[model samples]
Target: MNVPLRDPNIVMKLSRLGSFHQSKLSFLRSFLKEFKDWDYKRDLFELNEHGYGIAVYSFKKKNRVYSLICFANELDENERSDRVIATKWDAAFTLFDGVPAKQDIERLKNEVPKQEFGRLSFKELTLSRANKSVRIFNHVVESLSKGVQPDRELLDKVGYLYRTTAVYGSGKFGLADRFRIKDRKEIYGPFRLEMMLVYLVRQFTFDQVNHVAKNKNPKKAVKLDPEICRNLGIGNSTGLGMAPFIVNHPTLLNNWISARETSLKKIREIKNISNEEIELFLGCLKKSIKNITSWNTESEYQIKKIKSLLSDLNKFIMYLDKEFNFKQDFAFNEMYLDLEKNYCEECIEYVVSMMMEPFDDIVTPLIQEMSSEEGKYFNIPTERTVAELKAILENKYSEILNIDFSKKENNLNFWFISKNKEEPRLANRFDENGADLEQPLAIARDVKKLYDLLSVSKNSWTIAKFLSTNNELRHVVRRAFIVEKFPYSEIQDNTIGQEIMPIDMLRLKLSFFGALKFDPRSDKWLRICMFQGAPLPEQLKNYDEHWVYN
Candidate 1:
């Protein structure tokens, strides 16, 4: 039996996209799978008693090597901040393309810590900076120095010892442009190098904490248990800087959503399900609930969503355990329909992620398809008639056309780049001073304006002639043509609406990064934990493939 892919109109809405969860196709999980057989090593470790020095970790297979050079620094309590404007952090790092020599290390030590002000060479693939969770870091050090493990309750509450505020790659700063390394077979997936940087950073936290503890008390200090080490992952504090990424990279975003929808469609088409597959699906679903229950957040918006998700998940579990039958034909398809009819969007998406866990064959191949050559779709088809562009807009942007952009609430917010950090920011258009310089991120509003103009123009006029007259809508015109081919390319909602939750955009991107336990601090920024339940680097070889659910 063939099952239709979920409608892009329904799936591309910000709320539904925001409800997405990490699956087998998440870049981090796929990164681990790709590098599992490669050699893993701590190539360099030269830290002082205070854990203020240089460390290096590498993943080498044959002649290729990607080394993560880490520099741990001592920062006073007042110097540490997670905002993008902050200049100092507890640690800074860069993933070197090849192994670094003594001179290279010295060169990076000076610049990596300087962060945005520092210049990096093409040898650097990615640059990032992290601040320690001082309270948690100090508690762990004190506990380990006394020959005791830190409180698991405290560890679980915060989830990581350090939280990176930014991870930069793809020509940001002076890092190597993606064109230089895009052909690498191992890193064909999107953000694989970024994932590597964060995963290695996780190990650095463990090594740094252990090193500091041993130095505090050499006699009684004990190494942190490997189990505890595996439980702690790296944390990230993300802000409005991430929102523009999805809007600016339309083809890349479509590839991601397309891969996901394709995986779901293929899984739903399976007619016969084995007992093992059924057992695996149910087991993962049951075990993953711990992730939701332990999720700590102060934002009432997130709190309410979590409550609804948990409540709906419980109801679905009860139905699955009591009424569902594995013997039924196209069982997953039935399950999906039932989920959409009865559960909330959050629960439906949660179960959608779980469904992929039991079917690696369906998801593994799609991982490579998530990256896009966006340049191929950039040029608008100006040769087509004006009528063609109007029809594409009307069909592809049905819901978007209905939005009343003239209303104050519809045009309430504007997105602009900050002068200080050169990062994306959102503000009220009426109250703020920079609406005139607003970025072209309001796709829905602009598309509606394009439609109104198109409705008044002659149907037979070519797009080239129309664009020659109305050049202001060129960006949306380019997007409209692209969206005609890529259904999930455009977000089917008003981005500048007053009720917009910027964190929803962040969450959409983070979910693809395999982040868990999203803790939104506000509508604009959030904290997330990565690799919390993942295997340690040493255990990568011969590790359980489904360790995420373990």
Candidate 2:
């Protein structure tokens, strides 16, 4: 069968894209899979008993070494917060390009914690920080000091010892530009260093807890169980800050989704599935129930979705067990059809994820397709005629064109960078100031405007000529042509619409990061856990390929 991939329009709906789950194609999982055989070590651990000091951890293979230099500080409980506004964190971390010297650590110790305000040099690859989940951290310390593990239920409820507010890479805060290390085979996967930073931070959390416990009473203290340690992963608090990332990195977004859709297309084309692969896929689908049930969320929105997803999943599993036969050719295709008819978006996407679980031969290659050199597509094809551009807007942005931006609800919000932190923020265009300085995120409205303007222009006029008079829609014009090639690159809805759920954008990016257990705090932000069930760095050499499902 020579099947073209699924249409990007159906796959790129904000809700459908948001329903995505991590697979072997997820960046973090792929990163671990790619770098498993590289060396892992604690190159430096110089923190005091109070955990106020510097530490360096490294993963080296041959001549290359990526070191994570960490600085732990004693913050007043009041000083610790998970908001982007927070200036002080209990800990700050950076992935150095190579092993750092004492002088390098000393300079970084002063600036790294300052975050966005800090000036990082070219030697750094990525920067990030995490505030202690005080309740869990203190409880774990108290329990271990008394020689006991903390309750798994309480620990699982929060899912991590620390929650990172932001993980900055690719030139944010003056870090080494991505051009510096884009070619390194070890990190060709997107967010690999960020994953490594979070992974190492998970280790740091364990080490910090163990250190505090040992200091409290060396004789009575016991180490945290490795099993419990494995269960805990790094937590991340994401907000509207992540939403524009997808909008800005269109080709990157296309690569990620294309990898997923390509995997699905390949799986559907499989003619013969061995009994073992079928068993593995079903096993993962069944075991993943824990991820859903234990998925605690206070958002009534997510709660209802989860309830519906669980119900649909149960129904689909029953149908598979009672009615479906793997002996049939195109069995996975039939299963997918049943899922689409009988399941919620959540359950259908969930099953799609499970279907990929048994096909590494298919999934592994797609993993490499996820990362993109966005700059390659950054320049507009300004030589093209106005007619070609209009056709693209009409075809690719047909749904978007119907939105009447003159309505207050359609033009409800404007995305801007917060003056203080330079982070992304959404504000009312009429009520709040700075709409004049609005970031180029309102593609739907702008593309519609571009279409209206194009209607009056000469069809033979080049984009360069049109842009000379319409520079404001330059961003969306560039995007219209891009969407011609990468249909999944643009969201089909008006992002500034009153009904927009900004977290949907965040969830799309998080899913690609291999994050699990999204806990949305509001329509604008959410908390998620990463690498919760992943192998520890030491065990990466020979680890479970199905760790995400585990």
Candidate 3:
């Protein structure tokens, strides 16, 4: 309680946020912990010899049942693409509200594979489609059919057999909106249902691959080793489609970062360290080395980060073993200070995650706090005076206010939505044509403008009076008030600057989703693996909470 939370200005920086690692508060890990006791079943798996058919999996507890209806289809090697325009997918999946009947399956069979072109009824909660990582998928199939396990090194290299291009929910494509199911007890956490769908899809991957292998050599084939399956995960290729989300949802972003900061703050406040807790933290830290060392990426940007993380982690390990004393008071606080002083942002944040591994009592309660009722903070305080609004801008957005937006490079980029996909994209403002239609994702720049306008406004005038004339800055006005209450609400950087890395934005969100092995394909898009080394469906009931490091 004595140690202060990290400054929001420092924590909400794109560079620091981009360095975030998965922790206990991550939705996927929390999803597993929350629903582990539910009964899991292969409710309907009707795959053909080539593995093209409908399969359904469910997790049921009492009367509540959520089903994943999967439609695996044959795709030509040339047709398989992770692009949004690719109409055909190797498989399409939807998380159903309850068990899907034969008639319901038939209904979805016609529409699910059609993806964005199709309509999903209110019963479906989330929709996603993935293409095979053909080389890895076939390698697994061939190895299994030939009566052997796939090469461990190869499996380790690729990490997954399928890579999802998109996952949609919240009224998109006519699926059930958040308001419809937000009150569910099990889904109190944000993206819980999406996490559920993805987790179940992971199981489907193992099942489908094994089915195809068995069909290929009915007599000799063996199922994939559960050990190997445990190591594998679902891959995803994310683009700028996700970059705007962090900007668009300020309260939600605050909740996510606030949860992480609160956890770290609480952990650092620990006055005494138990020997057991120390060992658990160190054990997770030591085992997590493989996660860093095995991270594969061709992006020189990420390669440098990985190497720096590994080096700092090793240095930290040596310090812990040879010099640091757990018997000291507020040991975690002391260690955190050391990391901040001596390590890269990646290493500092990675250890921040490991620090929580030993403190379920600290992290568990915070999981429920990550989701936001964003609407609660939507209204601007129109009654407040211009003086108060300007004070907020000055106090909370100090870093943002300092950005020189008049510089051409600082104003070089714009965010816009593509017509066909309705996805957010980043473009060069000078060279690209859509600067005129740019979305208001330029939070820092706009906030700066709001500050400038406030500077000349009468201090005695209420915001209601100010807005009546300067209404164009209303969105940033709303956000400034939101940021006043939710400290981590806005990013403290120039989003449209020439040096901006949209991947940093995507990486921040993906880390919260518990994604691993982030491979930046470009500054605008990247690949990631989810549920890597997570427990399988059947093992859920008794899975280790720290499976990430195991």
Candidate 4:
């Protein structure tokens, strides 16, 4: 059965997009699914008893081997922090394109841990760092040294032994530009290397914990239980840094959300379902309750959401178990219809994620489509007329045009890069004084301004001619054209509005990264965990597909 995809305009709402959950289509999950059959190994492990030294892990298939070279350092308690402002971390990691020689390891050892200040060569595919989750790290070490596993309940609350502050890839800090490896079949999905880095980092955390425990009491220390090790995943501390990524990559954003919406529409169009498929869907939906129940967060906003989500989920499950029938045609569609009629946004989305759990054939094919050739759409379609451009904006940005940018609150914020680290940040336009150097993220206001200016221009003028004179508006003009073709490419709301939850923007991107337990420290930044219940590298070849639920 054929079904129409939702327009990008409606689907790209900050709220709708922000509500996204990790499904079979999420990049990390897809990465694991794609590379599961590849070779996995610890190519190098040269750490000292204290676990302060170098190590390298690799996954090779045929001629290609992506090596993760890890450098562990002894940092004083005061030196370790998860904040991006901090310079030192307990460990630093990079995914090298192939096997590194002695000279390559020596060169990288000097740079990877220093992070931003250190220069990386093109040989590097991705760079990242993780500070120890000191409380858990020390507790696990102490427990295991005494030959005991740490408490599962307490470990589940925080979920990781180390949370990386940032994972840099695609040309930032001299890492190889995406163009260098964009064509590789294995990594065609977005953020595959970053996923590989985080996944390997998860293994590193397990190794470090075991190594420290083994060292402390050679006679008594037993290895960490593989089951417990499987439950612990890498953590991430993200901030406004990730928010702009969605804004900047228009086509990529479109592809990610489109894959999701397409999957939903196809599921909705299904006319029949087998008993086993129905059973699998029901099983996953029931099992995923652990994800919601164990989801820990301190944000009152998120806590309230979790509470409401739990209440609604319970009701939906009750309806499914008691009143619903799988004999009905288009069973999932009917379930979805009932959900939308009865549940909250959180519940509807949660059910939507659970629906994909049973249809690996449908969702698996869509996973490969989540990545986009963003640069292919980067150039302006200069051959179009000013009249055509105006019509495009009028149709695509009808809601955005209603925003009165003259109000102080509507024009409240400006996005900029901090000079020290060159990281993205937002500030008050009137109070902070960097608005003049504002980044091109203020698309809603600028698109309106571009439209106002274009309304008076000759209808026959082409975009090439318009861009030649209106260079400042070039970015948004290019984006407007993108929004025309890729409906879900632009945020419908004014990002600079005083009421903007910048964390919402950050949450949207992090959700795509398969991050969970979003702990918003403030409106601007938050901590999250990645690969929290994912398979370790060694277990990748024969792993449970529903590890996230487990």
Candidate lDDT (C-alpha), each: 0.93, 0.87, 0.91, 0.86
lDDT (Cα, tens digit) per residue for candidate 2, span 291-371: 899998999988988898889888888888998999798888878877878777888888888899889889887776778
Give me the runs in candidate 3 sitting further than 4 Å from their true place. Answer: 419-422
Error of 2 at 377 (Å): 1.8
TM-scores of all candidate predictions against the true structure: 0.98, 0.97, 0.98, 0.96
For candidate 1, the C-alpha RMSD (Å) to the true structure equals 1.1
lDDT of 4 at 255: 82
The regions of model 1 sitting more than 4 angstroms off are none
Query: What is the RMSD of candidate 3?
Result: 1.3
Instruction: Kindly list the per-residue Cα lDDT of model 1 for residues 349-389, writing each as its tens digit.
Output: 99999999989889999999999999888888878998999
Q: After superposition, how far is residue 146 of candidate 2 from its true place, in Å?
A: 1.1
> Which residue pairs in candidate 4 collide?
8-487, 8-488
lDDT per residue, candidate 3, 233-268, as tens digits? 999988998888898899999999998999999999
Cα lDDT of candidate 2 equals 0.87
Please provide, for model 4 over 1-550, each residue's C-alpha lDDT reduced to its tens digit, 9 standing for 90 to 100: 5667765655667766666677888778888998899999987888888889998999889999999999999999988777777899999999999999999999999999889999999999999998888999999999999988898888988888998888889999999999889889899888999999999988988898889899999988988788888788887777888889888988888788777888889988889888888888888888888888888888888888789888998898899889998888778778877887888877787788778887887887777777887777888888999999999999999988888899999999999999875679999988988788889899999988999889989999998898888998988988888888888788888899888888878877777788756777788888788887788777889999988876
